[model samples]
Each structure stands twice: as C-alpha cells, then as structure tokens.
Target: MLYIIGLGLCDETDITVKGLEAIKSCERVYLEAYTSILMVPKEQLEKFYGKELIIADREMVESQSDEILLNANSLNIAFLVVGDPFGATTHTDLVIRARELNIPVTVIHNASIINAIGACGLQLYNFGQTISIPFFTDTWKPDSFYDRIKENKDLGLHTLCLLGKKIYEPPRYMAINKAIQQLFEIEETRNQKVYTTESLAIGIARLGSSTDQKIKVGTLNQLLSQDFGPPLHSLVIVGSRVHILEIDFMRFFAVDKQLYNEIVKKDYGI
Candidate 1:
C-alpha cells in the first residue's frame, strides 16, 4: 500500500492522527520538500514522529519517481507532503502512476493555505481563481497572472496570490512587497486600473506557525514599508463588494484601522 499524507500547515504535531498511524506503519517514509514547507525542520519531525525520513527534493520526485514507486506493490511506502496531497498537481500525477502499477493508494487530507486564508475574515466563497506570483527577473518578467487577477476583480471576487519559492536554487521565496511591485508594473503596462499603490491588500507570513506569525492589512504602499518576517507568505487583494462584518474582522489586523476603514468605505463602498 502507498500512503500519501498531508502534514498540515504548521509543524510536526499538526499531522492528523490517521496520518501519524500510517507513517508508523509504513516501512519507508519520504518527505516531499519542494512544493511547500513546514514551520519546523525535518529533524524536529523525525524526533516527533520517531521515524527516519528521506528528503525527496524536486529532482528525485520529478525525474526519479520510479524509484519511489518501486516495490510499493509489496512494501508499504509513505509519501509525506507539507500540505494536502492534492494541493500540487505533481502528486496527482504520482497517484496516476501508482494506479497504473496496480499499487493501492490512500490519501489523508489536512488544512492548507487555500482554506486557511479565511482566517483573514474574507469569505471563502468570494474568492475567484487563485494565482501564483513567481519571482521576476530583469529579462524574464511575466505578467500572465495579471489577467486572472483582473478577471477576479471584475467579478467582484477576491484574489489570492500564492508567492513562488525556489527550493533547489538559492532557496529564494517571493515576498509580498515584491509581489506588489510586480502587480504595479503589470497595472502600469496594461493601464487597466485593476489596482494601485493605495489598493487594499493583506499580507500574511508564517501562517499556522506558533510564533512570529504576522498579518497586516493595509495599502500596497503601506505594506511595502512594513516588514513581514520569513517566507511562506501570501497576499490578498480585496474585492469590490465586501461585507461590513468582514471589514470589522479584518480591521483587527490592519496597520492603520482609520485608513483601512476609510479605504473600504470610499473605494470598496462597503
């Protein structure tokens, strides 16, 4: 049997009871490290779960998956993911390969940023297509995601931008400030007025972690000035039609409550 388990959003303790049991029963355990990351290190998880883990980086998972699937038909192999197994399409492809090999598979689900972003008080149903913002290079700036964000904003829906992370390279994670700068560049080029420096945005860092988790609600210009420590950060663009209750709830995390209230009332017409 092959077990694909989600480690949830936080540290080792965030693993579900069923996931833990599956890991304990498995003969070999592999931790998928490229897709997303946990708050704690792999050593901490090994100590907590009392299981030795083999780190599966992008190269191993993408190019050498056959090795991972080898003997799965006879031996129990556990593939651990930082978030839900289905969060990344790569895992889906692995499941398909396993099925072709006649290997039975079991999936364990857990909380991911897709749903946990609701902690900011935005209605989940109000979110449109989520987009990822990759780190831009001087010669490789891509604004294709801008069209999707525009579509979401046009329909009065919120946009959730998942920043990119380069694990194998220098281990660079796209920060919210850089994301805002990219968005501004796109807006300037398109002139669609989708958003501006004064746009209401939310920046969340180290979500689901026990300590140093930060949430700041403010304009893009304001957020750029403030520091949100660490990686694994996400950004949200407020929709045009926001409920008063959401405004009230998000205000708790606002950098300037007065400015947030004014912007919501004047621009969002809440």
Candidate 2:
C-alpha cells in the first residue's frame, strides 16, 4: 500500500494521529521537500516519528516518481507533504501514476493555508480563484496572475495570492514585501486599477506556527515598508464584499486602524 499524508502547516507535531500511524507502519518514508516547508527540520520529525526520512526534491518527485512507487504493491511506502496532499497538483499526478501502476493508495488530509487563511478573519466563502505570485527576474516577469486577481476583484471576491518559492534556489521563499513590489510593478505596467498602493492587503508569515506567526493588515505601500520575517509568506487582497464583522476582526491586525478604515471606506466601500 502507498500512503500519501499531510503534515499540516507548521511542525512535526502537526501531523494527524492517523498520519503518524501510517508513517510508522510504512517500511520507507519519503518527505516531499519542494512545494512547501515545515517550521522544524527533518531531524526533529525523525526523532519524533522514530523513522529516518528520505528527502525527495522536485527532480526525484517529478522525474523519478516511478522509483517511489516501485515495490509499493508488496511493501508499504509513505509519501509525506508539508500541507494537504492535494494542495499541489504534483501530488495529484503522483496519485494518478500510482493508480496506473495498480498500487493501492490511501491519503490522510490536514489543514493547509487554503483553509487556515480564515484565521485572518476573511470569509472562506468569499474567496475566488487562488493565484500564485512567482519571483520576477530581469527577463522573465509574468503578469498572468494580475488578470486572475482582477477577475476576482471584479466579482467582489477576495484574492488569495500564494507566494512562490524555489527551494533549490537561494532565498527559497518569496517574502511579503517582495510580493507587494511585484504587484505594484504589475499595476504600474497594466494600469488596470485592480489594486493600488492604497488598497488594503494582509501580509501573513510563518502561518500555523504557535509563536513565530505574524499577520499585518495595511495598504500595498504600507506593507512594502514593513518586514515580514522569514519564508512561507502569503498575501490577501481585500475585495469590495468584505463584511462588517471581517473589518472589525481585521482591525486587530491593522497597522493603522484609522487608515485601514478610511481606505476600506474609499475602495471597498465597507
């Protein structure tokens, strides 16, 4: 049997009891290391789960997945992901491959940023299509995400921008400030007015961590100046459909409550 388990959003302890049991029962455990990351190291998880984990990078998962599924018909193999197994499309491909090989598969689900984002007080039901903002290069800036964000804003639905990260590269995670700068650059180039420097945005860093998690509510210009420590950051663009309760709740994290209220009133009309 092949088991694909979610490690939740934070550290080793965040794994579900069922996931832990599956890991223990498996003969070989592989940790998917590229899509997202945990707060703790692999050593910590090994100490807690009492099993040495084999690190699987992008190349191994995408190009050598057959090796992972090899002997699964006879031996139990566990493939672990940092968030919910289905959060990334790559894992879906893995499941498809396993099925093609006639390998029985079991998936254990857990909390991911897709749902845990509600912790910032935005209504989950109000979210539209989620988009990822990739790190821009001198000759390779992509503005496709801007169109999706505009489409969501047109419907008065919230936009959750999952910042991109290349684990193999230096500075693996995209910082909130860098994401804002990229958004600003796009806005300047397109001039669609989908969002502005004065628009309300929430910067979240190290989510699901008990102690290091940080959330800041402010404008794009405001957020660009503030520091969101470390990696694994996400940003949310407030839409016109924000509820009164959400405004009240977000006030707790606002950088400047009065400014936030004024912008919401001017842009979101809330």
Candidate 3:
C-alpha cells in the first residue's frame, strides 16, 4: 500500500488525524520537499512523527521514484506533501504510477492555499481562474497569465495568484514583488490594461502558521514594495465590488492604510 498524506499548511501539528496515523504505521515515510513546505523545519517534523523519514527532492521524485516505491509491495509506504496531497499535479502522477503497480492507495487531505486564500477578505466563490506567476529569467520572461487575469477581472471575479515554488533544490519561493514586476512588464509590452502597478491586490503569507499574515487593499505599486515575509506565500487581485465587510476584516493587517483605502475605492469598487 502507498499512502499520499497531506501535511497541511503550517507545521507538523497541522497534519490531519488520519494522515498522522498512516505516517506512524507506514514502513517507510518520505517527505515530498519540492512542491511546498510547512513553516517548521524537517527536523521538527521528524520529532513529531517519530519516524526516520527520507527527504525526496525533485530529481529523486522525477528520476528515482522506482527506488522509493521498490519495496512497497508488502510494506506501507507514505509520501507526505506540504499541502493537500492533490494540490500539485506531480503528486497526482505518483498515484497513477502506484495504481499501475497494483498498489492500493489512499489520500488523506487537508487545507490547501487554493481555498485558504479567503483570509484576504474576499469571497471564495467569487474567484475565477487561478494562475501562477513564475520567476522570470533574463531571456525567457513570459506573461501569458495576463490574459487570464484580464478575463477574470472582466467578469467581476477575483484572481488568485499561486506564486511559483521550486523544489528541485531546497525550495525557493517567488516573492510577490517579483511577480508583480513580471506581470507589469508583460502588460507594458502588450499594451494591456489587464493589470497595472496601481491595480488593487492582496498579499498573504504563512497562511496556516501562528504568525500567518494578510495585507489587504494594496496596489501593484504598494504591494511590490511591501514584504509579506517567509516563503509559501500567495497573492490575490480583486476583480470588482465585494462585500464591504471583507475589506473591513482585512484592514486589521493593512500595511499602507491611506494608499490602500485610495486603491480600494478606485479599483476594488468599495
């Protein structure tokens, strides 16, 4: 049997009750370190789980999965993900391969950033297509996400931006500043009004951690200069008018109140 377990968003304690049980029972436990990560260190998780787990990097998972799955025929092997197991597609492929090998599989789920961004004071149901902002390289800047953000804005729906996380090495998180810059650069070239520096946005960081934070009613200009702190962050761009209660709730962590209020009225449709 192969178990795909979700470690939730913050720390080791965030693991679901069922997932923890499987981790303790599994013969070999592996942590998928690439896609996303908890706020705590791997050492903390080992102490909590009471198991000697192997760290699986992208190279190993993509090239040496058979090595991890080799002895699972009679043993219970578990692959732990930082968020809900299916939040990333790489995890989905692992399950498919396990099925081909006739291994019975079970998924233990938990909170994922996909639905966790509601803390930004926006209604979850008002969200449209979610897009990822990738790290721009010198020669390969891509802004294809602009079209989707525009499409969502046109419909009066919010846009959730899942900033890219690279797991090939130790996980490297893309900051919101870089994301905004890349988006505006593309908008600049395309002559598009889809997104601009003055566009209203929200930045949330460390979603499930004790010190988790949210900054509401910021513009691309204000948001780009602000640091949300830590990795594993996400940003949201509100499409149009929403319940004023949402804005009031998010104001508790407002970084730049005067500017935020201005943008919220002009862009967020107050």
The best candidate by lDDT is 2
Per residue, candidate 3 scores C-alpha lDDT tens digits across 63-129 of 8878778778899999998888877544766777778888888889888888777767788989999
At residue 118, give the lDDT of candidate 2.
96
After superposition, candidate 3 runs with Cα above 4 Å error: 167-170, 212-214
Q: Write the per-residue lDDT of candidate 1 for residues 190-235, one digit (tens) a residue.
A: 9998888998999999888777778999999899888887888899
lDDT of 2 by residue, 1-270 (tens): 999999999999999999999999999999998777798889999999999899988778878989999999999999999889877544877888999999999999988999999999999999999998988999999999999999999999999999985645533688898899999899999999999888888999988899899999999899999988887899999888888999989999999889988987877677
Model 1 CA lDDT for position 206: 83
Listed in order, each prediction's TM-score against the native is 0.96, 0.96, 0.92
lDDT-sorted candidate list, best first:
2, 1, 3
- Residue 261 lDDT in model 2? 81
Clash counts for the predictions, in order? 0, 0, 0
Better of 2 and 3 by lDDT: 2
Model 1 bad stretches (over 4 Å): 167-171
